[model samples]
Target chain A: MIKAFIALVRRDLLLAFRHRAEWFNPLLFFGMIVTLFPLGVSPEASVLRVMAPGVIWIAVLLAGLFSLDSMFRSDFDDGALEQMVLSPYPLPLLVLAKVLAHWLVSGLPMLLMAPLLALLMTMPQDGIAMLEWTLLVGTPLLSLTGSIGVALTVGLRRGGVLLTLIVLPLYIPVLIFSTNAVSAAVAGLPMGGQLDFLLALLVLALTLAPFATAQALRISLS
Target chain B: MWNAIWVFFHKWASPRYFYRLSGAVIPWLWALTLLLLLGGLYLGLFVAPPDYQQGQSYRIIFVHVPSAWMSLFIYTFMAVLSGIYLIWNIKLADVMVRSSAMLGASFTFLALATGSLWGKPMWGAWWVWDARLTSELILLFLYLGYLALVNAIEDTRTAARAGGVLILVGVVNIPIIHYSVEWWNTLHQGATVTKLDKPSIHVSMLIPLLLMAGAFQLYYFSLVLMRARVELLEREWRSEWVREMMGRGSDG
Candidate 1:
């Protein structure tokens, strides 16, 4: 069972790697969104700095949401999901593997590229550490929870926009805590407190979301 | 003992049984709800003593507090029903979930609207991102999302199961919303009635508040039972009881 799960994970990774442009698409979208903020608003460095955390976080969240639509779309179309459900392996473990792969492909790239966007926003040097920490702890939760949304909406005809409506409200708390954590660090207040809350949220999502996603898949498949 | 309770719960999973039972009880439930609401309002509005602080405006609590309590209570009730639906493959439980979502969402909206009305006088702002208020707003979204999800799917079973899973997952937010005022730096005031220590308000005020709360509970039961009856008929149109109901309606 473990071997099959790993194999499924590797298969998804390789498939994602083969379409590398799709992987880069979200990063580009993230960057584009961040860039548009300056054009839409004043380009003053101080103004950009003030809005940086929120802009970057919102952009990353949108980018994550964009990529999440495809989390189960391909497997669902090709009967891969059905086969896995029939497989000897547990459905929840299979879902965990898929979410792990989704986090790697969609969420990790956003985290990796966040610093460059932070530079574009003229984020203070001291704030970057907390920014990175927040993204590291927070984005995976977004990916995991977002995948459940993706799974629920996977088989629907007009799912993409509805998916956003369903998922974004749920994402508000994570966004609030993460942005607050970074802002607190920028202010030189104790960062530990908000970071601890973020970690707790992450742990909570990790524990419960996969089961929810697996159940969603069952509903979609049925 | 546990198994017997499980068996009892499982027995009512049938849509036909639930449909007939809810149909039979809805009129009585509606009558009860109407009586209680009228009595509660009279006691709450005319009879209940005004608070020393806010005076007449404090009467908003009679509506706001009960709706807020109903909001949380209905979500928990929906979640429990969804759990039963998932575990027992109960069609009636699914209907209850669907009906409850609508009732819960309305109560959430009522809570927020009444909260805003109350807040304008007290807090001097129409709206604030107070923990309790914000969490309640999020609860509205959760209820909306659940309804939208079930509607989006074409298949009834799929919709029910999908909405069920979402409801269970979203259950995390309930407690967070409940405790947000305590756990975070929020603008909302802390607990008023459910404090562990001595009661916060005078007995006169507390009595109306409790009465209003009971009225809201009855209101929810009345509506849920009514909606459940409609859902039962819609889902079980071909069943014999439904045909009998249709024939009886025509005869009447």
Candidate 2:
């Protein structure tokens, strides 16, 4: 089972790299939205500083959203997902492996790019580390929960908008906590409680979401 | 006695039996809901004395609080029904979820609207990130997500099963969402509870709040039954009992 998990993750990563454009899409989208914020809202540092946490959190979420619609699309289209479902090893483990690969390619890039966005927003220097740490914990939870959404919608041809409506609500708690963590740092308050909440949520999602994604994948594909 | 109860439930599982059973039961539910709502609104609006703090405007609680309660109640209820459907693959449980989602979303929306309306007079803003209000708004999005999943699929059974999985996932997040929202709300503003709680209001106000909550529940039961019957007819349209019903012939 562990071998199968690695093979699935390796295959996903290789595929993600082979089509290098896909890797850059979420990154470029993240950069563009960060750029757009100043145009839409304001260019002043104090104004951006006040709005930095919310602005960066929302951009990361939208970039993740942009990438997730295609999470299961290629696998489902190529019939690889159906083969995975029929395999003898446990399906949930395989699903978890795929989610891990997705996070590495999609969420990690967003997390890496977020610092540049934070710089653009002129967030206080002290708050940057906390913001990065919050995203590190929060993004995988998005990937885990987002997989359940993708698995449910994988079979439909016109699933993009509907996918957003289904998945974005599930991201709210993560957004609220992660953004608050950064805001606390900005306000010079103790950030432990908010980070602890984010970690707790990540643990909950990590334990529960794979099984659900596996079940949803089976039901949708069947 | 246990055997008889078991046999009774076995019969109740049949769509034909349920259609008739709901028809027989809903009138009583409707009558009860109407009485409670009418009585509750009258007492809540006129007889209940003003709050020392907010005075007359607090009466919106009659509509606001009950709808907010129903919002959470219906989602948890949907999770229970979703569980039953997932385990037993029962057709009726799925039918219940199909009808319940829209009603739940509307209640969530009403809660937000009323909560905001109440906030403007009290909090000096059109909206505040109060824990209850924020969580209720997210609850609305969750309902919308479930509805979107159910409607997006072409097959009824597939939609029901997929939406069921989403409900289970949503249920796991709800408490965490509520807790996080509360924590976030407190981090920004000082510690304060929203008006949904009753410490400030007297028993005269409390009675109507409880009554309205019960009335909202009864109204949900009747509405869900009515919608369930429509979904049953749609799904089972080509089956034997439905054919007989459509032919104006007695099945028994």
Error of 1 at A11 (Å): 2.0
Give the Å error, residue A202, model 2. 1.4
Candidate 2 RMSD computed on C-alpha atoms after optimal superposition onto the true structure: 2.8
Which one is best on DockQ? 2
Q: Model 2 residue A211 lDDT?
A: 93
What is candidate 2's lDDT per residue for B53-118, written digit by digit as tens? Answer: 788998998898889889989999999999999998888999999899999999999999988888
Task: Compose the digit string of candidate 1's lDDT tens values, residues B1-252.
Answer: 999987776666566566667778878877887877788788888888877889899899889999999998999999998998898777878888898898899999999999999999899999987888878888888899988899999899889988888888788766754454335557776678999898787787787788778878987897888888788778889988778878999999
Going through the candidates in order, their DockQ values are 0.61, 0.85
DockQ of model 1, rounded to 2 decimals: 0.61
Q: What's the true lDDT of residue B169 in model 2? A: 88
Task: List, residue by residue over A1-222, the lDDT tens digit for candidate 1.
Answer: 789779988998999999997688988999999999999998999898888888999998999999999889989999998998888888989988998888899889889999998998888887888899999998898988898899999999889988988898778877777787788777778878778888988898888888888888888988
